[model samples]
Target: MPRPPRGAILAVLAAAQFTVMLATSIVNVALPQIRAGVGLSDSATTWVVNAYGLAFGALLLAGGRAADLLGRRRVLLAGLGVFGSASAAAALAASPGVLIAVRAVQGAGAAAVAPAALALALGLHPPGPARSRALAVWGAVSGAGGAAGVVLGGVLTRAWGWPWIFHAVAIGSFAVLTATAACVPAAARTERARFDLIGTAVSALALTALVWGVASARRAGWTDPAVLAAFAAAAVLVVAFLRIERSAAVPLVPPRLFAAREVAVGNLLTALFGSVWIALFFFLPLYQQQVLGEDPLTTGLGQLPLAAANMLGASLAPALVRRVGSRTALLAALLTEATGMLWLSRIGAHGSFFTDVLGPSALVGLGLSVAFVQLTGLSVAAVTGPDAGLAGGLVNTTRQVGGAVGLAVLATVAGTVTSHAAGHQPPLEALTAGYRTAFALGAAILAGTAALAALLVRRTPADGPAHAPAPQPAASGRP
Candidate 1:
């Protein structure tokens, strides 16, 4: 088949990426309804969401390797098939256990596709305006798709039912998969290399244990044996993974990726943003439902201020960077986001979304969208050829891991505060205390991201030193 136009390829890839990410936050808009229908306990409700995160975060590096060893198109197609089918199953699920199980499968499929699809976009477009534009679009779609998902989820849940959101995904997956097969040109297939199967397995096990343990501690107690064991196992698995990477002929993730200044900071920021974003999405909806007594659709609508601003900021951010250095832009965006979060720390249940949440939400959206592009540019700047897979994977891994950690920490803080306040106060007041604690922590997180961005990112820019001018068509390596 003739090579598809880069434009066409990007549009398809962006839609695919957008749809995958959209699924992440879309469910939040319908969580209340889903919980009621599935008869989930308040404490157990988190697993419904976190299950997807655990699987996606655990398998990312291996997914990148799969893309490299197998083929980006092949991996992407397989992932789409899995994700779409899982969505269907989830929609039809009769119990919380079934829904959670299917969501996990969906997340696994997403892990397989996201990095490979991103790598394909980078590889298809050469470095320059074209590549930048593609990345910018990628950033925009990231926010836009998520925003669309919120509206879609609310609309589907209110109008049709929560299950329709997944049903829509089922249809979307089929269409995107067909277009992907027909449109994405096959690249020159690389010579297959051995993959670190042990490393992959250990890494997966370690992260799952660590995340589940930390997340569980809010209810299970800090001294819980399960928590202690999880941390210990994660540490051991991490060490094992490092050893395997050091010795393996072809590792899933090269050790050197951690050393790159831009890559490192970029990953850190991605994680930070993911954590805060997920926390906001999760907690805000709870506030709306439990404290404000709003329906799912109304709650989703309340988020539009942030969503629309994110889209606008994403469209303009590339130009902003060409003027201000990426480091400066990133810091500015972080500070702005922090300010918004700080303001949110004072938000009461009685306040309106437009007055109390609108300003902060818009700033958060801007922060999310702008910082995302800078992170992408930095991640991809030094990357050329197929290393895009690993680079994309690293950025994504940071986001997923950060999301999981952020959610755990926030939940812990919220639970502690809410528990304390519950003994003496009305439910709304107690919930407000929990929200304040969580939002305050969110502010600290953004501030930390700003400081890190300033220190690690170079003022005088270079994609930095090249690992290689161009890569050989060898398998299982990063950009």
Candidate 2:
């Protein structure tokens, strides 16, 4: 088969990426509809989102390794099949249990797709300016995809129904699948490499337990027996995973990968950025809906400025890195992010969108986009070509896990603060206080991230030193 042009390949990959990411937050606006339709309680409804996140975050490492061993193209195709099927099933689901189950399946498929898509794009574009340009496009799509998910969800839900959102995803996934098979080249597999089943099991179980514990704690309280049990189980399983990696001949995650200063620092920063980002998405919609009396569609429209700003930030990142150096750029962005979060913390029950939300959101979006692209370059800098997929998986895994954990913790804080303030203030005022507290905490997190980046990230090539390593051709099952 003749290879497609590089641009065409990237377009397909970006579309697939967008679809996968869209699934993460698209349902936010439709949550109320889903609950009413399925007769789900508030606790059960939250699971509709958490189920997907838990599966996606837990299985990502295994997914990344699968791509490297089974082949990126092959894994991507399989992922699309699973994702499309699951989306169709979700659209048809009538029961709360069924919807949650299928959403988890969708997440598993997404885990498979994301790292493979990234690795494929990286493989196609050589390092330096070419890779940076490609990454800029990819980063922009990712940022826009998350925002689009929320907007599209609201539009489709209002116009048609909540189920239509899933239907759209299914159609989009199928379209991308067709394009991928035709345009993307098949990469060679690692013939001798073995899957680390034990490592995979422990890591997945550990993450699931941790995320479940935190998410459940919001309703169940921190002292709940179930939550305590889950946390303990997670700790034990994490230790087991580390031990398994130490002994496994072909570890799912090579322990040595974390030794690189750039990789380590980059992942930490990703986690911090991801934490605030997820929280922002969760709370801002609530602010617009419950506090400002905006409908779902209006709330979605209100986010356009942030999405546009995110694109602008991605487009400007490469230049910023060139002008200021990766370390300095990252530090500045982190500080900027912190400032935006602080600004947003001033939200009030009577506030207008332009005055209270727009400027701060755009600032946060810009800072996050710049940080995302720079971090992507830093995170993968240490890995050999053979492990690029693994590196991608690790970076994404941290962000997802961090976001999940942070959301749970932040939600608990907000809930507690709101409950306390309700005794002394009006309901809307209490709610605003809760959100402000969470945003303030988020700002502190970015400040700490900036300090870490300043101290740890080197003042060198954002993509790493030119002589760090050479590309090793991946094997194809066929000679």
Candidate 3:
């Protein structure tokens, strides 16, 4: 077959990426409707989101490695099949158990799709101005997907019902899959290294346990025995995974990857970035609905400003990086986001969206989009060859795990504060107080992230003399 145009390949990959991120946030606005449709208890409704996250986070590393060994195009196709099929099933699900189960299956497929799609994207252009431009598009689409999910979810649920949200994803997935199959070229596997089965199992279990424990703590209380047990199991499994990696001739994750300052510091910041990024979407809608008394569709439409600002930031990132350098640009972006969070901390119980939400949301969206693009570029700056998939997987894993941990911690803090303030304030006032505290704390975290990046991320591929040389690509496979 003739090779597809680079633009066509990018379009397919971007569609796949957008679909993955959309699934993550689309359910947020529709949770109430979902509960009504499936007869889910409050706790079970939360699982409708958590199950997908848990599976996606746990299986990412394995999926990335699979893409490297089996072939990027192959894994991408297979993932699309699974993800699309599961999404269709989720749309038709009537029982809570079936819905939750299919959501996990959807996540499992996402794990495979995310890294492979990213690796292929990176391979389309060499590391330089071209790659930076490509990454800008990636970041814009990714950031837009999360914000758009809310908009689409509200409109779809209000107009057609919650099932249509899943139906939309299913339809998009199949369309992207078809385009990918027709356009993306298949590459032969290059490396013949032994698969690290033990490492894969241990790492997946450890991640799943850690995320589950943190997620449960919001409802179960941090001191609960089951949560404690889950944490303990996670710790042990992590240790075992480390030991297995050290000894395995073909490690799932080579220990040396962390030695590169770019990978280490970049991932650290990505974690912080992810933590706030996810929580912002999670809480903002609640504030609109619970405190401001907006309906779901109205709340979703209100997010349009933030989505616009996010895309604007993404479009500007490459030029900013070129002008100011990655480190300086990153610090500026982080501080911008922190300032937004601080502004958000002043939200009032009786506030209007224009007075309380718009400005801060725009600031947060702009900062988050630029930061995501920079961090993604930084994380994979020194990676090449088959390990591109691994790098993609690792960066994504950190983001997801960080989001889980951050949401859990922030939720706990807010709940405790709300409970304490309920005696002195009206219910709406009490809720606002909780949200204020969480936003303030989130700002502090972003401030800390900026300080850390200032100290640690000394150079990037875009930084001329200080940049490390990327390894040459292998002879047979896609880089």
Best by lDDT: 3
Candidate 3 has an lDDT of: 0.89
Which candidate wins on TM-score?
A: 3
| Candidate 3 per-residue lDDT over residues 1-479, each given as its tens digit | 78988988998898999999999999999999999999999899999999999999999999888877778888899999999999999999999999999999999999999999998988886677677778888888898899899999999999999999999999999999999989998765465678889999999999999999999999999999999999999999999998999999989998766767789878888998888888998999999999999888998898899989999998988888877777787889999999999999999999999999999999998998888888898888887666888888898999999999999999999999999999999999999999999999999999999999889887544443112345444443753
Candidate with better lDDT, 1 vs 3: 3
Q: What TM-score does prediction 3 earn?
A: 0.97
Off by over 4 Å in 3: 189-191, 459-476
Ranking by lDDT: 3, 2, 1
Pairs that clash in candidate 2: 188-475, 188-476, 189-475
Question: How high is the CA lDDT of each candidate model?
Answer: 0.79, 0.85, 0.89
Global lDDT of model 2: 0.85
Which portions of model 1 miss their true places by more than 4 Å?
256-259, 461-479
Please give, for residues 230-277, the per-residue lDDT of candidate 1 as tens digits: 888889988988888888887778765555566665676678877887
Superior by TM-score: candidate 1 or candidate 3: 3
Candidate 1 lDDT score at position 279 = 83
